[model samples]
Structure formats: C-alpha cells, structure tokens
Target: MKKIGLAWQIFIGLVLGIAVGAIFFGSPQVATYLQPIGDIFLNLIKMIVVPIVISSIIVAVAGVGDIKQLGKIGGKTILYFEIITTLAIIVGLVAANLFQPGAGIEMDKLNKTDINSYVDTAENQESHSMVDTFVNIVPTNPIAAIAEGDMLAIIFFALVFGLGISAIGEKGKPVLAFFQGTADAMFYVTNQIMKFAPFGVFALIGVTVSKFGIESLIPLGKLVFSVYGTMLFFIIVVLGSVAKLVGFNIFTLIKTLKEELILAYSTASSETVLPKIMEKMENLGVPKHIASFVIPTGYSFNLDGSTLYQALAAVFIAQMYGIEMSIADQVSLMLVLMVTSKGIAGVPGVSFVVLLATLGTVGIPVEGLAFIAGIDRILDMARTAVNVVGNSLAAIVIAKWEGKFQRNSKPKSQTTEILNVN
Candidate 1:
C-alpha cells in the first residue's frame, strides 16, 4: 500500500472486496456482519455532502460580484450543458443500435423488477417541457432546498446571494469578504478531509464488493464492460479533444483529479467528491469564481456520465424489447435527454430516474428499468467519475469562453495551506 499508488491500492481493495463478497454472498450472517462497514462509509460521505454543498455554494456565490452576470453565465451554462448532454445521449443511442447489446438476449429469462413502487415516485420526478423546466429553476425556500439537497434550488439561491453581495456597493464588501472567508475556511476543512481519501475509498469498495460479490458481476460483465468501454472512449476521444482545444492535457487532468474520481467512484455519487474537486480546481489555477459557479452548476446541468448512461441504457432496453426506433425518433430521444438531464441534479439515484422519465420519448419499455437496476449501482460508479471530469472541464471551457475565468487562486491557496499548517 505504501509502495504503490492509491489507485493500485484501491484496485486491490476492489479485488479483495469482490473476493469477500463472493465468499459470503448467499450467507446472511456474513452479509449482515459486513453491512455496517459499507453503511459507515456511505454515511460519512453523506454527512459531509450537505455542509460541503452549502459552504461551497455560499462561498462560490459570494465571489461572483454581479448577480446580473448570473443570467449570462446561467444561460450559457445551460445551453452548453444541453447541447453536450444531447450529444452524449445520441452517442449512447447510436452505439447501442450499432452494437445491439440486447439483441437475441432473452429478456423473458432476465430478471424484471416491480418498478411499480418507484413508478409513482418516478412519475412525480421530472418531465421535459419548457415551462415546467423553466418554472422550477428558482427555489421557493433556499434553506429547504439545501436541507433537501436540491442542486437547482441551491444554485438559484447561491446565484442570488452572490449577486446580492456584488450589488450592494461598498456596503456589501464586508459581507462578501465574510462569505469568502467562510468559503476559505471550508476549503481548508475539505483539504484535511481529503487526506484520508484512500482509506475511505478502500472501505467503501470493500463493503460494496463484499455485498455484491464478483459472481454477481459475472453474468452482467457484458453490460458493465460495454458501458465502461463507452465511457473510456468518449473521455479519451471527445473529452480529450475538448481538453486539447483549450491547451490542457486530459491525462494530466485525470491524474490530478484521480483522488476525487475515486471518492466519487467508491461512494457512487458525483456530489461525494465535490469538495475535493473544488479544492483541486481552485489550486490548479481555475479561478474561484469559475470553480464556484461552474462546478456546482455543472453538477446540475453537465452530467456527461449520467447523460452517457441514459443514452446507452435506453438503447439497450429498446434492443431488449426489439424496438426499432427511427432516425428521426432517435434524434428526438437525444433532444429529450438533453433537456431532461438538466433538471435532475439534486436527485438521488438520478440516472435511473432520468432514464425512466425520458425512455418514453424513445419508445422503450419502462419495465426495462428493472433489467438494468441490479447493475445500475456499479454503472453509476464509473459514470459519476466521468461526470466529475466533464463538469471540471466545463469550468475551464466556460471560463475561457466567457473570459471571466481567473487562473490565479494564490490568495485562496495560501490561506488554505496556512490553515492546514496550523
């Protein structure tokens, strides 16, 4: 563990975890005994989520001087996210159609879940339409939104508060500075938390492997491999191209962000590694303003992994039902995904939810949800890491595009380091 990289350590933990699970998968006693370890890891990550989110948003927002610019950034952010998410979904649909993953596979033999219980909840989740999507953009109660972990609502409130700080002229300077100081304090706190990352990831993966086992993955390796391969291809080809265009190296970006990705991977939630991500971006020379606005907002709008998952999973389902979607219909499916993916940021287990919400547009069976449900958790781990990559890249891209990005985070960095020293 000390000789090699943490990534290797994590790989070992994953292998061992799988071994442990396979050893005891059918044994209730062992499974029950091992359950608490996973639960503790999940809860520890979750415990930080609300505080990290609120503190980060408040600080990130306070850095934004003009709330009016919120409209411009908000507009551009949404537009860019929708376009990419749509493309991602299109990629998934096209790949599934070409690959035909579900072709000749017997769905009748595959497990079907009673998503009926989730159906009512899913139906009330989110739908695609201009008015509904637009109306829900602003939060009615920012505090309630934060407590509920509503990404969009929290974003709305932060934008407003940050802009307010900017608008209050000389009077707001103290208030803005106060929030900035608070944000700085939180960044220090997050950095300290991140030092324990490798162990946390190991524990999380260990418990997960122990619970699910390697044999469970045996039957579903096809789906997992396909999704993992697809994500890797896009991250390299597509995201690499985007990084190149901006004069950044995707490999370096990956290396720098690996710890955050691991955190997200082990926890299976993009928000899980958000604090570390924010700290890294700010340290890597992305301005605090851009990091603050784009990262959190990107969490909501620019979900490359979730978007990719939706497209791939949807097409896989249609193939299971032997449904042939037309060229025009396929394009429409991408369009719906592009729009629907934007509204799902605050949602827990949003990938499945978004897939269910939008699959109707592509003419796939919603019952197909169950067929993929067993595998969704694992799939989410891979893509949530990708989503972090996508959004972090977006922070740079949007900053470059708008020319508001500050590559200097020295003041913030020094403050953070000094706090850690103490």
Candidate 2:
C-alpha cells in the first residue's frame, strides 16, 4: 500500500481533532490529556529553530562572500518586505473600515478575558525607542542572545560571523564546512520532528476547540469573520499581485507550501515551519543564501499577517467602544501600527500587545482588548498561515530581484528527498 502524504495525514488529524473537540467541548480532560502532546511537539520545533537559523544563515552569507552583493540582497529584501507589509497594513485598515466588524455589537454580551499580562508587555515594549531596538539587535554576548532565542541579535551576530569567516580566505573553509554540516543535520532532524506534526496538530486544535467550543465563536463571529476574510483578501489580491509581478503564480506557490501553511495554521505558530519553509524555498529555486537571510529576517521585520491584524484590531477596538476616529486619527493609528508592529513577532500575545500599545495612542480603551481576547487564537491561526506564505514569497521575490531565481529548478534528488520526508 502507498503511504499517506503528510498533508493528508495532517488534514485527517485536523478533522478528527475538531470532531473530538466538539464531542468533548468545554471538557478540562482535553487539556489534561492533549496539551502535553502539543507542548512537546512545539518544544521540539523550538529546539531546532535557533540552530537551524544560525547555521543556515552563516553558510548562506559565507557562500556569497561578497559584502557588496550581500548588501544589495539585504537592501532589496528589506525594501520588498516593507512595501508588501505596508500594503498589508493598508489592506487591513481598508477592510476594517468597509466591514465595520465591531460596530453595533453589545459589548456587555461579549466574554472578556484578563488582558493585564498583554498590557504589561505592551508597556515594556513601548518603553523602548527605535534606537534602542536597533542597538539591541547587536548582541553584547552572542551566546547569551542565542540562549535567549533573541532572533534579531542572533541574526546580526551570524551575519557578522559569516562575513568574518569569508574575510579570512582559505582559513574560513573549516568553519564554513562545520555550519554547512550543522544545517544539513538539523534539516534531517526537522524531517524527523515533522513526523509528529499530525499528532501535534490534533492535540493543539483539540485543546483550542474544547476550550473555546463552537458556541464561544458565535458572540464574536463578525470580528472573527472579518479578520479571516480580510486576511484572505490580502493574501490573494495584495500578495497575488506581487507574485504576478515577479513572474510566478500565487496559487502555485500556495500549493507548493500547502503543508507548511496547514501546519502553521494548525499550530498558530510560524516557527513550527521555519526550517521546512527555508528548505522548500531553496528547492523552488530561491538561492539558499536569499532564502536563509530573508525568511528569518522577515520573521522580525516582514510580519505581513501580524501587522495587518494589528491595524485591523486597533480600528476594531475603536469601533467596539463607539469612539469616532477622524481621518487623521486613523492615519495616526496606521503610522503607530507601522512602527510598533516591527521587532515584536515572536512575543507571546503579540497582537494584543501591539493593540494595547497602539490603542491608547488613538484614544481606544486598552480594556477593549478584553472583549476579543477570547477569540484571538481563532484569528491567530489564520494570520500565522498568511505570515508563512508572505515570508516564503519574500525569499522568492528577493531571489528574482537579484537575478538569481531559477524557476522550477529543483533537482530530482531534492524532490525525492522532500517526498521521502513527506
């Protein structure tokens, strides 16, 4: 008998999870039984992320070995990320205005969750200036940054270290070889870990569904619907246009990344698929250097999904509170979101933190977040999928811009390797 594909296995897990969750809706037993399985799976993914990022980036940059070329690629990558993410913000704002998801909702009827933790996080995040953020990206201790899983600092150190290796000429060969070996080994481990993804998806979704239940969604249905619908719009219309301009089909890209997208959505954490996305993008003809550098950096700087949700959620809270936002007020909200949304992707409750930081500036009550906190996970899952897609596409766009994209250029061996993993 032919083996089942990973995507189909994951889909089966998702469907089964929903069924079980619906059957045991609101049962604490679901959490007791399933949360550990899910946590273990997530922890396994986390274990490999930093190493994969560091090694892959070091190898990619060192392979290029030309500061001028690296700079050009970096510049083009950031520019593309900024343009696309800004478009995401604009699309979100426009969708919120048109949909008015929160308008006329009876606030008292909505279930509220404690948002004090996110508020505190927002306050701390707000205390830092842009200068501080950039400064912090240069690690005082690279080892400590890696220990803390500080992605920006780690990226900075890796880039410099890789360049150092390249600068030393033939002496760098040993170090580069070590990182290349580490990257390959970690990818092998990633494939092994992915074998457990269906179980992870089932447990994670089971917990979420049991906790929230289908009924919990009914009260905030409009907000949830609007968020999902707007994200779909952004992915298709905004990201699609970008893909077309770059001489690729968006649907094909999505199909190529279906497994990653599903895992991201189910887990509601893009980190789960980072290694796989980098691997797949390289297979799809994005150079290893471009894919490695752009995808990880995009995690921090180019969060198209999170930024869009922040824009939409900020206005959403304002609407829920019946606050009249003038055109200038909305524009200010947009600007604040554009600034505040950066460098906060991996933070727990990040969307809420961003909204808390942003809402106060626009006169939206921070407490308004309590109204939507209950449904945030449902919203988060969709956004995470979009983020994975956006970042994967970023690597491709940068590769194309650098005149390096080789369409359908995946070697037969690599194709076989991916199939074997699946």
Candidate 3:
C-alpha cells in the first residue's frame, strides 16, 4: 500500500492527541510527560531557523542580479504588508464592535488565570518610537544579532552583504556559491526536521489538551468563539478576495500549504514552518529572492492575524469592564496598535504582549488579560495558521505582480486538484 502523506500523518496525530488528552484529562502528569517531547521538537526547529533564514536571504539576494530591483521588491513588499495588516486591524475592530463578546461577561464568573508573567513582560519591554524602530534594524554586531535571532537586523545585514557581493561581480562568485550551498543544506535539514512534525504535533496537542482541558474554555466561550470566527471571516473573505484579484484561487494556495498549516496550527508557532514555506513557495513559482525577502519581512510587518487579534482583544477587554470607547478613541487605539504591533512579528506569545501594551494606553485594565490567558493557546492555533497562509499568499501575489510567477499548466496543488490517468 502507498504510505499516507505527511498532512494526513499530522492530522491523525492531531486527532489522536486530542482523544488521548480528553481521555487523560485532569492528569497533570500526562501533560508533564508529553510537554518535553514537544519542547524537544521545538528546540530542534529553533536550532536551525536562524541559519536557514540567514542563508536563504543571502543566496536569494545574491541571485537577484540587480540591487535596484531588490530595493523595489522590498518597498513593494512592505507596502503590501502594511495594507493587508491595516485591513486586518480594521476587520478585527469591526468584529469586536459588532459582536461585543465581552459585553455581558461577569467578572465574578471568570477564571482569574495569573497574568503576572505577561504583565511583567509588558513592563520590561521598552516601547520604541518609529525612529527608534528604524534605527534598531541596523545591527551593531551582526553576529550578536544572529545569536539573539534578531530577524530584522539579520535581514538588513544579509541584504547589504548580498548587494556588496553582487557589486563585485566575478570576485563575489565564491561567496555566492558558499551561501547557495548553505541554503541547500538548510533546506535539506528543514526536510529532515519536518519528518518529526507529526510526533511533535501529537505531543504538543496532547499536552495542551490535557493541561487546559475543555473546562477552561467555558467561562470565556464567547470571547474565544468570537476571535476564531473573526479570523475565519478575515481569511475567507479578505484574503480570498485578495487572492482572486491576483488571478489565483486562495484555496489553491491553501492546498499547497496544508502540511505547513497543520504544523503551524498544532504547534501554535508559525516560525516552525518558515523554511518549509519558503521552499514550497519556490515550488509554486515564486522566485527565491521574493519568497525569502517577503516571507521573513511579512513575519514582522504583515502580521495580519496578530494585528486582528490585538484590535479585538483591546475592544473585548474594554467591553468586559463596561468601558465604552468612542469612535475617536477606537480610531486612536487602531493607530496605536498599528505602530505597536510592528517589530514583534515572531516573538512567542506576542499577541498578548502587543495587547498588554495597547490596553493600558486605551484605558482598559491590563488585568483583564487574565480572563483569556487560559484560552490564548487555542486562539493562537488559529492565528498562527492564518499567519502562515497570509505570508504564503503574499509571496505568490507579489511574485505574480512582478511578472515572475511561473504557473504550471497542470494546475495541480498538493491538497487538491490532482488528476489520475489510466
């Protein structure tokens, strides 16, 4: 018999994990045992991420052959990211106003999950002005930036280094060849790492379910459902429309990204799928430079799902406290979120961090975060999946816009549109 595909392996793992966790609910020991497996898997992915991103960016930029075109692509990618993210914030705000999930919430009925950790994190995080943000993108020490996994700084350094190499023409061939080999090695490593994904998904989901259980979802069901529903709407209507305008079906892109989405959703970490997404985008005819540059940058600037959650969470907290924000106040809140949400793309639990910062500024109680802390992981799963999809589509759309998308005549996608012949 033919073996099952990776997507199905992960889907099965997800299902079994949920079943096992439900069976073993209220058993902290089970979660404790399974948690390490997931942690190991995550560490393996984290170990390779910085190197893969660095190598890919350098190779992609060196291969671009024209620094002016590279800059043009960079500018267009940022513009696209900004437009899409702004739309996400607006959609999220609109959903929060229309649904008012927290309107009838009773403070006494809510579970008070300790949010001290998040609050402390928020306090320790220094808010950067726009000028400071721009300045921080240039690393003083590129090696230190890589050590800290500062993606923006690393990208900046790689772009300049790649351009310098390209400028030297024949003399730069060896440098270009070295990075090309590095990119190939990292892609192969990414493939090997992905083989462990199903097991990781199983462990992660099992632990998550066993620890949190369905009980934690009860008190804040409205808020959880609202966030999920809003995200689904944004993905289908907003992202789908954008894909249609770009002359491709969104479902086609989704089909291609099935495995990556499953991994991202189960892990609630989009970074896990970055290298794989870049590889797959190349398969779908996005040029390597565009995919590498756009996807990494999108993680920072094009955080549609996170920005949407921030807008909704801010409004949800205000409603929970019976605080009414005027139109002008909400507009101001959106403006704050727009600025505050950048520079936090791939950080763990970033949505909460962004929300914590935005809430205090908008006069909402930061402590309200405790109410939804229990359900954040569940919501995070959806958003992470959406983020992967958003980035994937961004690469495709930008490639098509640049007249670089190479369409297959067969039009076959990984998850759908396959044909069989006798």
Please, what are the lDDT tens digits per residue for candidate 2 over residues 10-90?
Answer: 988888888888999988999999999999999999999999999888887777778899889888887887788888888
**lDDT of candidate 1 at residue 392, scale 0 to 100:** 86
Score residue 31 of candidate 2 by CA lDDT. 95
**Taking the tens digit of each residue's C-alpha lDDT, what string does model 1 give over 1-422?**
54876566656655666566566666666546655665655566566666655655555555555556656876787777777677677677767776777777776666555565556546866444656666776888877877777776776777677666555556766665565566666667666655555555655555566556665565556778888888888788888888898777898889988767766876687766777777778777776666766787788778898888888888778777888878887788887777677766766678877877888767787888888676677898999888999988887777777775565445353333322221
TM-score of each prediction? 0.88, 0.96, 0.95
Relative to the true structure, candidate 2 reaches a TM of 0.96
The lDDT-based order of candidates, best leading, equals: 2, 3, 1
Instruction: List the candidates ranked by TM-score, beginning with the highest.
Output: 2, 3, 1
Candidate 3 per-residue lDDT, tens place, 289-350, comes to 88888998888888888899889988999999999999999999999888888886656689
Using lDDT as the measure, the top candidate is: 2
Per-residue lDDT value at 308 in model 2 = 92
lDDT of 1 at 106: 73
